[model samples]
Target: MKTTLKIAGALLAGWAGLAGAQPPAGDADIRHGRYLIQTSGCNDCHTAGYMQKNGQVPEAEWLTGDAMGWQGPWGTTYAANLRLLFQQVDEQAWLARARQPMRPPMPSPSLRAMSDADLKAIYRYVRSLGVKGSPAPAYVPPGGKVATPYFDFTPKNLPPMASQR
Candidate 1:
């Protein structure tokens, strides 16, 4: 009898935990999501060759992330594969991640400013695309050796600051 009670309790707990999971997004949500992604320029960096092709990349290839890196004072940061990232995390986790700051040239401020509905729509839209490709190369600190081709973002020849006066 005691064993039965414990099993029942565990089952109930599992069911309750699932209750908070996000539901499947409707067609409208997905469409809005696509719109947001395009308008917000997510494809520029996240999708390889997006800008080079003038946004002509196929939808199937969108947001898979790029091997290319952006190197600057902070470090080299690769755009993450949103599809794979979504697969690894639930909606709630995505929300938390979206709110956190990311190194340049990522626009973390734009993500943090988005409403929950907008964020959810973006998440749904990306997830709907399904996972493709492997994870991007890991971050390399400033001055670290980078194997992949990357854009040099280091500033050069800046004028002296007023504080130098």
Candidate 2:
């Protein structure tokens, strides 16, 4: 009888532990999303640029949405800080942006082809990164009869500087 009671108690304890052992679903999604965002290079557009402090780029400030160029045909274009934007921009918003026609210098070809699941994962990852407000770039449309050389829309034949090469 004592053995029986011991076995029964053990079983009860095991069941209680199992109940507590259930894995969390939210963590899995957030982790997966973070992996996809890093691989996708989402920061190339969404981050206005890295923040410069004392003329040096800080690693922590990366993906904070300061990388966006405001001088393109689109005026005051600031790459929405993906971290914050992801929270505000849902899966649908991301899907629409992905499907829209590609604008010059912004590469959407690969993103447009991504599966819906992938897009969601990417969005989730961006949101997890966290947001910091980036400076708004002044609007300068490319080559729109605008005389500013900085705004010239013409594709330069010169190879990108040594770093880009």
lDDT values for all models: 0.93, 0.58
TM-score of each: 0.86, 0.55
Worst 10 residues of 1 by lDDT: 15-24
Q: How many backbone clashes does candidate 1 have?
A: 0
Give a tens-digit lDDT track for model 2, residues 43-128: 55554332223324443554565433435444333455566656677677887987787554555688788887777666666666
- Most accurate candidate by TM-score: 1
TM-score of candidate 1 versus the correct structure, residues matched by position: 0.86
lDDT of 1: 0.93
